[model samples]
Target: MCPPEHFTVEYAINPWMDTKIAVDGALALKQWASLRDTLTDLGHLVHVLDARPGLPDMVYSANGAFSVDGTVYGARFKYPQRAGEADEHRAFYAEKTDNWRFFAPEQVNEGEGDFTYLPGAYGGIVLAGYGFRTDPAAHAEAQEILGRPVISLKLVDPAFYHLDTALAVLDDRHVTYYPEAFSPASQRVLAQLFPDALLADRSDAEAFGLNLVSDGRHVILNTEATAMGHKVRAAGYLPVHVNLSELKLGGGSVKCAVAELRP
Candidate 1:
């Protein structure tokens, strides 16, 4: 997780971003600190990636790269506004990590923003989202790098621009997502893959409910996802809440700020 040092909504890349509505930098910092602390309290190591200037969306660190085992598939952003962030991620990995193989992607992919790895689901599979921020060709590239079957799920809703905005992999076996955010074929694919999936209603989804992270049992929900909290509890996962109303202005929540680095 990177600190929201330079976090702001200067550009309107996504629907949630509005340059007119000014961001509370101090509040965003507090929210980021809380998220880091909360995850720390949950026994998760929160790695801090230094934030760079001119990249407000750097706060959404999950888009940096995708790592599993010892292999890292570095991100190649679609939009030029976020293009610099990819190199920042690559540089960080080269400087910080040990013995991890890194691959600079040729295809356009937004790392964890589009690729979600379920280490234990279907004996391990990557549910890759496309037709939005990520390119479908990137799925094959990722599958080769990670040595896992990459399932292409197409995103339709502009609001749910990234896959993380519409889906949360709660654990190896469980997931919760907004069905409408995906295309009909994609929705059917998900239903076939996760038959017992927890479906989030439009209201909860619009509240940024699906943008979450889970340590299998504990799911950290964003602000105003009240219905999501109830749904997760009903599905037997503990709902840990956080107030990221300020961060939500930039269209990201817990999952976006936190990148999963699997060993």
Candidate 2:
């Protein structure tokens, strides 16, 4: 994870970003530190990425890369603002680790922001979101590279630009998402894939409740998602709340701040 050392809404790419509202740099750092500490306390190993000078959005490390079966798929950012981040991530993985293969995508794909793994009885099933930051063609390329079935889901809402912002995969049988963020066909696809998944209410979804990180038993989410927390607990998972309001100014929260290394 990279700290928000250079984080700021200098320009607006997503609907959530407003250059007029100044981000609290100090508060963002504090919140990011707390999140890192919380993950460490939860028995997860945390890896820090060096924050580059000009890449402000580098703090949202989930968009950096996607790893599966020891192979790292580097991001090809759609926007020029985040274009430099792809190379930095590739270099980090190339230099910092061994026993990993790297594959830079030929098409534009925002790493985990659009590609999420779904755990199930099958060996591997990936949910690929597109029609926003990610190109739909990249779905096939990702599937070929990873050798997994890729389910393409289309995003319809500007507020929920990335799949990570609109949905959270909670183990094999369940997921949490905002139905309206997806196109009607994608909504049907979700219903078919996860018949019993928890659907987030408008209030919770607007609070970025689906922008969460789960470790099978525990879920880390925004403190503002009070109602969503109750639902998570009801579904048999511990809800850990963290105030990432300052980071939200830059259009991210708990999940965005993390990048999982899948084996």
The digit string of per-residue lDDT tens for model 1 on 151-240 reads 999999999999999998999888899999999999999999999999998998899999999999999988689899999999999999
Q: Measured by TM-score, how close is model 2 to the native structure?
A: 0.97
How far off is residue 133 in model 2, in Å?
A: 0.4
What's the CA error at residue 250 for candidate 2, in Å?
1.2
Off by over 4 Å in 2: none
Q: Which candidate number maximizes lDDT?
A: 1
Clash numbers, per candidate: 0, 0
What C-alpha lDDT do the candidate models reach, one value each? Answer: 0.91, 0.89
| lDDT tens per residue, model 2, 88-108 | 889878885776788998899
Model 1 lDDT, residue 132, Cα: 78
Candidate 1, lDDT over the whole model: 0.91
Question: Could you give me the TM-score of model 1 versus the true structure?
Answer: 0.98
